[model samples]
Target: MEVFEPFLAGIDNPDHRDRVEEIFNWVKTRFPNLMPKIAWNQPMFTDHDTFIIGFSVAKQHMAVAPEEAGIHRFSEEIVQAGYDHTKELMRIRWDRPMDFALLERMIEFNLLDKQDCSTFWRK
Candidate 1:
């Protein structure tokens, strides 16, 4: 969480900031093996330097980027979770509930899928 302090602090809305912090902490606690860092002005997690997941704050929602493959892999469930998405990111509206279970699955999938990857991003 310390790595994300400066970014979290920059959020003007305390509620939004706290919510993001809670999610970040949850990911850290659940997957302690994941390395946390700030990249492209966003908070991201990587395994062996390969991106597992990333997050960004938007005007009306927080976006979760598990990469295009993750998005296509879980498109059905993402809709069921009531979140909106594009090929690159899922948007969780500030007023809606977060599906942490879905999030965990996404991270796990990425960790395993990219376990042997040698680059920062999938090619």
Candidate 2:
């Protein structure tokens, strides 16, 4: 959590900060091997220095960026989970519930799919 304190501090709303922190802590605890860091002003997790997932905050929603492949692979479930998404990221509205199960799958998929990737992003 310390790695993300600076980023969390930037959020103006206490509730928003707590929500984001909860998600971050969940991921960090569930996947202890993932390295936590802030890059490009967003909180992201990487495996073996390769980006596994990332997150950003917006006024109406929190954006989950698990890379293009993660979005593509889970497009259906994403929609079913009550979120909307672009090609690169999914937006979970502030009023919506957190889907930890779906999040777990996305992270697991990325960890396995990118295990052999040699770049920060998929090539």
Candidate 3:
């Protein structure tokens, strides 16, 4: 939670802050071993110093970025979950019930997929 305070403090809207906190807590609790930090002005989770996933807030959605490959791999599931996405990110509506299971899978996949990675970002 400490890693999130700085980012949360920057959000002026109470509702937005609460929404972001909910998502952050979900990720934190779901993957207790992942290290949390702020990077590129967003909340990112890392495993063995490599990025697993990240989240950011937008006007209409909470953007979930699992890099572009994850988005491509889970394209069908993402659409079925009622979210919008692009090559690098997914847009999750604040009012909708988040698909925690899917998020868990994505994180796990990322961890395993990038196990050999030596840096936070792919080269």
TM-score of each: 0.98, 0.98, 0.92
RMSD of each: 0.6, 0.6, 1.3
Q: Write the per-residue lDDT of candidate 3 for residues 14-40, one digit (tens) a residue.
A: 888898888789888988999998888
Candidate 2 residue-pair clash tally: 0
Q: Rate the local accuracy (lDDT) of all candidates.
A: 0.95, 0.96, 0.89
Instruction: Report clash pairs, candidate 1.
Output: none
Q: What's the lDDT of the predicted structure labeled candidate 3?
A: 0.89
Candidate with better TM-score, 2 vs 3: 2
Model 2 residue runs over 4 Å out of place are none
Candidate 3: stretches off by over 4 Å: none
Question: Per-residue lDDT for 78 in model 1?
Answer: 98
Between 1 and 2, whose lDDT is larger?
A: 2
Model 1 per-residue lDDT at 123:
95
Clashes of each: 0, 0, 0
- Better candidate by TM-score, 1 or 3: 1
Q: Which lDDT tens digits does candidate 1 get at residues 22-54?
A: 999999999999999999889999999899999
